[model samples]
Target: MVVSCGLLTANKERVPLKGIEVEVEVKDHVAVVVYTQHYENKEDKAIEAVFVFPLPGDAAVCHFSAKIGQTEIVAEVKEKQEAREEYDDALSSGQQAFLLEESDQSPDIFSLNVGSLPPGESASIRLEYVTELAVEADSGLRFCLPVVLNPRYQPQGSEGHGVKVTAVPASLVPYSLSFSARVSSPREVLKVDSKCSLEPLQYLNKEKTQAVVKLAAGHKFDRDIELFIYYKNAHQPAAVVEAGKAFATPGTIIGDPVMMLSVYPEFSQEVMSSITTSGEFVFLLDRSGSMDGARISSARDTLLLLLKSLPVGCYFNIYSFGSSFEPIFQNSIEYNETTLEKAQKKVEEMRADMGGTEILKPLNHIYSQPCIPGQPRQSAEGTDGHVTVTYTLAGHSFHDKLSFPLQPTEDTGLTVHRLGARTLIRCLETEKGEEVKKKVVEVSVQSGVSSSFTSFIAVNKTSREAIHGPLLQRRIPGVWSRSCYSLSQQAVVPMMLSHSMAKASRMQSHGMARACSMQSHAMAPAAMLQGNTLGVKAKPESLSVMDKVKHLFRPESKCSDDPVPTPAILKHPDSLLQLVSLQKASGCWELNPALAAALNKTSKELEQPKPPKVNGNVWATVLALVWLHAFKLDAQIEWKLLAQKAVSWLTAQNAPSMTECIMAGNTLLGSNVQKDALGL
Candidate 1:
């Protein structure tokens, strides 16, 4: 995906970023992407334009070059400060220059400076990076190209700064985009799917292991472009060995042959059945203003499911932060009916009204809390950061795994080694010794990977045409739009929020008391109360069945006299969410109207088909499993753990007639799920 930031002339006139062309080549699990951004100066003065964009967090930018007329200047890796000095010197000497650097706060963000472009001049920027494709839950290799970058929030007195973005609505963006991909793998390419329009996949080989696809013509730059590529035997392990740079010094990473290994482990049913029931589960949710709309709603729904899925004997706590933080309880509490209900109620009331994104304080508070004896804490958040494991869900399947090793292969260049070096530099930068810093710089320079201490700089020293006047600085504006997925949407908002918060901090720098007041307001509780209560009490009553039916068929009227309608009708909670909500803390479903509604059946119908000796809970649970396998297979990633809990509960009960229950459930639900599918 191309995050193309358009250019603006020094006088604030449009410099017209002509277009963006993206070419992606996928070899097995790794992708090599090349982006060419075209720009032309239409005005009558020399201007220095800046472009800011984001890449995949883990991508390694191995190449950056600029072509002006017939001259192409390739950048070289150097210390960030040295590169800045060189760029400034080149510009001062009336020569064209280019500088690229990674952001301090986030590795994924990058800034490119095109210095001293004479009027009527045109420049084409060529940037290349390499990243590994993520595995989706449905066993598809997922690739995404983002078009929107939301703001990030920065608190006062923060050390690092955020990007300053002048947003342009997607509809108003004036640039064209072209995207295409060539994918080849040892395994057969089952198919490729996307939410955006795409040309039909074309197989390039008789074995169907190589194919090509492209985004359809006239595509708009609104939502992110997501491509899900499925392959037969996707989980099968494979390796690629990339040959090292021939001319580089031997003994260095660049001169060594690198092997990339991909492994997906499968656990036996016995091991899966032995899931740990003990842990201190701490959930940190972001309630920043950027999270308004579908983003907050999605988070609330995911939080509710997690609360319901917690084991009965475990302990858990809920904390939400924006500028401030609030906990559902004073400390972690044992999971039971009362605690689960209270947490669920509080989660349902969560809103994205917490002014800014100041997460440090809440994170510190959580860490300060005394650890429960023998219960390790697992903290889950709704923001971007380090994660040990990830579970992905496609339309109807789930897969999990992230890291892989690099091997030696001809014509692969040093992409794998550069990526590895980048990873190592990041790890060592977190250390506290001069030796660590030295090693990080060494690896960054040797492997040509941009890092916190290094940057990419190039100058047109051989150009005959010279820039004669003082250059005016210009900032390019990128299209800002809403993301299709809530998670991706969250990623877009924080960059802008961070910019605003940083501006606020600068404005308040002169007055300590004012800064303190702003900070106080940011941290002030939205609905904090004494004792165990953290959120407003649950609604005293729910809508009646008649009211629900009316909600479904209700006509829109602007009249204020009509009672405020409920949030949803028969479609509000959705069948999957409704079924998950009815699950007890013990992991079994209770036979009830809500459960029947989720399954699109009557309570009587669900109860009548159960085997004579099977427990009602067992029958209800079996129906839930059948519905999941038959209808909600695409969301298995979300419900997998919870379903496992139900299976374990059933196994402990030694429930009789499980096969009969499964058969009866299949018949009642019009599904053909087998007993083994439900792990009976």
Candidate 2:
């Protein structure tokens, strides 16, 4: 601590010289405390109090208590860096707060911490810094290190101090965040052989298509059960429909079902050491009129932050959709230093234009010529979906009203045509510069951070790069992967994509659709008539008619493996999926896998068990009934007997705590079980 005392004091006979101000600073384990004496009167020596941050553990605050003459002061001591900002709204002595990077500031975010003075007179200030620790792996080749918050103290004198952290294997405390789903169950734990349909749903899109999940457990504490809604789609599931509302948008289709769920059985400590990063994603922004103002601004900020965080060589592209969907041509502008600058500038200059949200235009454009356009589709699914989707492109737009409708087909390659009107949206260009498509488009959910892909691509795996978590890959093919930093809840996809896809009808209006289409006209091959096939994967089990659905929304998963659409997608509620009607295509897409297994069985005793009666909840009983009808309930396994037991289990269910067993169970058990158990 340095303190200077000016020597100029009055000698009796002569005029006194000035006494300059001096400051005193205290250094501690996590913080450096300081006080300055400011001259109330220059004649009285000017004493200044200044706290210089010396610790590295990023802390944004400090504490202070002082007595400078009659000035009775009680104020929070702050690091010089933090004290510089204005905050009349801040707390007086406790809870001093400040933004590490102001919203207006182009912040290169690092870590930040804050501290407080001891609550009594003549006491030392207490300070704390946030830091994270994880296990390390030194396999022959260096695995990427996780990016952890380094704890350091920035006390006026102490530089940020590294925290002594021990990595303790941890598990995410299971949390409960659920709404009453109104699910049902059939059968009890030990008795009841009748097939009682237990249903939790009120009315879903008026489809009346319900599931009768069959379930059973090994024992009471034995929750080895898989209770996902397993069913067959006969042919194909319908396209998405705008059945519910989210984010205050009217007639907006949900990116996921109300019953949709994402479950992380347990928060793994592994999340701390490895880079659980999603694959390299290219964000295709919709700067259409509907995405004006707050949406655009938020997107700009979000994208910039994401660009700043991406891994080096992680590819991406930024395209806008308005009157026309176009990329800033490197032919006209390069991807060089100047080009990136111009690209950012171009983004700043962007204003949502009123134009058509053409489905085929952007996909065809980016696919035919990628920005990094070098890679080819990994499989036939990728290639065909791209080609066919590129064909189904339409310039029509829809807004909140009639935003989407079920599509029988898109003009390009082949598509399952199963999703609804509102489910489709634009594609993200990838490292290969091709449009990364999705089987299940990842729409925005209100969790996780957006990727700073632009920045990620610039990063080199230097040792200094924080060993954060594992870099998650493209679980499947899709451009935009999950975001990393938003710390909301579980990691979630961005909501903007689905929101825009649902609003396509806005551009489809007669007034703007034609003109927008004319401005970006390109010949499409929708004119060529070619019969499309579902590109069925035979080696793998065929996708049950309900490939990605469950009895109710349970988070057995989130699909980052789906294909994304090109150009702009037409949004509607139920994305119409086409079932290859055996009569129409002269092809049987598939039969329910379970039923097939049952049918293929040759055991005489196991053949076609008698139909059972219902007993408990509507969902379980109904599901049991359906399974019996479909697979004819095998008798060897005593499916009817099992169905009866399932009904009895539910009938006696006043209050049961099988949730944990169900959640962790690997069998047919469920969290909030709706329907289950047809013995065999």
- The C-alpha RMSD of each candidate to the native structure, in angstroms, is 14.1, 26.5
Please give each candidate's TM-score: 0.60, 0.21
Name the weakest run of 10 consecutive residues (lDDT summed) in model 1.
531-540
Candidate 1 per-residue C-alpha lDDT over 1-680 given as tens digits, one digit per residue, 9 for 90 to 100: 73434443333457446788999998877788998888887767888888787676667788899998888999998988899999999888888899999877566678889888888899999989887665555567777775555344333343344466555667666678899999999899999899899999999999999999999987777666778888888766565556778888887777766554555434444544554456677776778775675457656665666676667787788888878889999988998888887887788788888887666688678767787885555224432222122221111123343333343335667666776665566546544467877787788888888788888998999753666667777677765534221212122221101111112211211111111112111111211111001111111011212222332334432222223333232234345666787788888998766567667666677688889999889888888989999987755655777888888888989988888888888899899998787777
Which candidate ranks first by TM-score, i.e. highest? 1
Q: How many clashes (backbone atoms < 3 Å, residues ≥3 apart in a chain or on different chains) does model 1 have?
A: 37
Q: Write the per-residue lDDT of candidate 2 for residues 1-680, one digit (tens) a residue.
A: 74434421122111111111111110100111122212122222211111111122111222222232333334332322334342212322232222121111111122121111111212111221211110011100000111122111122332223321221111211111111111111211111111222233243223333222222311111111111221122111112111233343443323222211100011122332222222223444556654444345435533443333222222335666545676655321212334344555565566656454443565455546533332111113221111001111122222211122332223211111111111121112111122322211222111111111111001011112221232111110011112222211111111111111111111111110011221111111110000000110001011111121221122322222224331111111111111000000110112222222222222222122212232213322333334343433221111222233333344445324333222222122221332333221
| Deviation (Å) of 372 in candidate 2 | 4.9
Question: Clashes in each model (backbone N, CA, C under 3 Å)?
Answer: 37, 172
In model 2, the Cα lDDT at residue 313 comes to 29
